[model samples]
Structures are given as structure tokens and as C-alpha cells.
Target: MPSLELDRYLGTWYQLAAVPQFFNLVCARDTMATYALDPQGNVSVRNRCTTWMGTPNEISGTATVNDRVTGAQLHVSFPGVPTQESLEGPTNYIVTALGDDYSWALVTDPSRLSGFVLSRTPALNEAQWQQIRTAIEAAGQSQCMYLTSPTTGGLSGIAPLCTV
Candidate 1:
């Protein structure tokens, strides 16, 4: 499969849903991620969230587009963390589908090992949901887990359903 276009993929994007990371454990109200061009032209990330204590938490990181044409892989590092390490190895950001106006996007790893549904806004439409679902299936990641993002207008009452 081809990769996503890097330039078009850059910019601030709201996290619709993710696999749930340790850093976001205290997120209670809202969580957002912003991507911008860094000084070296790499991708800079700023992740913000409202903590359970009602305090704001923000982390800064940087990302490098692995493949220019495919924009499929990236290596992210948190400068604030010890040793400035990355959470994961070079992960693939396979572009599954994109919104007509580039308002939303569905991306997965090359192996379909992980996935995320991102949008310009916190919420997405039914059409967008279906599109993501289709993309997930197409990527052979139907067994992957789906997270509950209450801050993004998703259900928080129940646990996520893992197909695997």
C-alpha cells in the first residue's frame, strides 16, 4: 500500500481516538495534539490535556517523516522525558483514508498493527466513522482494539471492545 502525503499530513489534528497511552492516563476532560514545522523542518508535537486534578498537562515532542513520498513512518521523541526516548519504534503512519477537505484522516501502521482516527474537530460524522471502519477492515486490523475518548465526545461509561 502507498503511504500518506507528508506535507498534507502535517498540522494540528485533534485526537478522535487512540489505543490509550500511559502518558494520557490522567486525561479527564480533553486531549489534543498539535503538529507543526520545527526549526529543523521536522514535525514538532505538542500534546495537551486536562488532568483529573483539573490541571493542564502538556508534553512536547518531535517527529521526522520517514518517507517523503509515502510519509509512512515516523520516529517521535519526547524532549521532556529522561534520555529523550521515544514511546515506540519507527512506526508507520499509513494513510488509509482522508477527508475530502483534509479535515479528517484514518491511519494505520504498515503491518496494520495499530490505528488511529483523527479529525480536525473532536467529533466525526457517521460517514466518517463508516469510512474509518472500512479502512480498518481493509488494513486487516479489524481485530485491533477501539478506545473510548469521552473528552472527544465518545462513550466513557463502558470498556472498549477488543476484537482480538
Candidate 2:
């Protein structure tokens, strides 16, 4: 696993593609997530997306670093959500791949059932997209077929190769 520089990783990230989650099913476009380092060293997470009804939906959560040495594993929890009691352990979120300049990242859970391709901008270049796809495969996840391309109006209107 690669180590993550918390400072560099903190900021707004657009979701270029992701395996569909029930909670995000309502999202139609402009999906994004933001991370901020809290005073206590924990990370505050805020996710937002344009809903199918043309409204914005947002959720706030918190993530704690599970391994200081690597800083790639995280235990994330949304308020009032029973993530801790779920079958998967709390440390499910991991930074599987990170761009050298903190421009993009690939994140997945321990079960490989959840994954996200995130970028600093709404779209990634051809080379960046290729790198992210390769990283997703390397992470042992095959459900890329379920990834939905967010329409943030930045990629020359190119459709995602994956089928939703």
C-alpha cells in the first residue's frame, strides 16, 4: 500500500466514476467529496451531488486514520449510520492509488465492493483515466462495469467506457 500525505490529500475531489451505491443512486451529476483535516487530527468529509430531481444532496462524515505508518487505511463513519456495526470492519476505506501530484486517487473498501475514481477536476485526461482504470484492476475489483460517469461538463462529453 502507498502512504498518503494527509495535507496533500485534504481538499475537494470530484467523482469521475464510481461503483453505484444505494445512497448515491439519487445522484445524477456533479458528484464531489471534500476532506478537511480537523484540529484533532481526524478528517472531516463532506459529499455532495446533484440529485435526479435537480436538487443538491449532501452528507457529512468523519474519517480517522487507522494506521499512522501508512496513512492509507481509514475508518469512516457518517453520523447516525451504523458503519461500525456492519459486517465489514470500520477500517474498510483504503487509498489504493494516489497521483504523484495529488491530482487523482483511487479509493476502495476492504471487500472491494466499493470503489471511486476521484480527481481534482471534473474530468481526467486520457492518460490519467488509463492510469486510474489500471489501478482499479490492480486493486482486485471487477465491478468497474457498475461505475457511473458523472456529468460535470468537463471531459469533451466523452462517455464512460463502463456500462452502468
Best by lDDT: 2
RMSD of each: 3.6, 2.9
Tell me each candidate's TM-score: 0.77, 0.88
Which one is best on TM-score?
A: 2
lDDT score, candidate 1, position 85: 71
lDDT of 2 by residue, 62-93 (tens): 88888789999998878766654332246878
For candidate 1, write residues 56-135 as lDDT tens digits.
99999887776667666676788657644764556545567787677887667666656666777777777777777676
Candidate 1 clash pair list: none
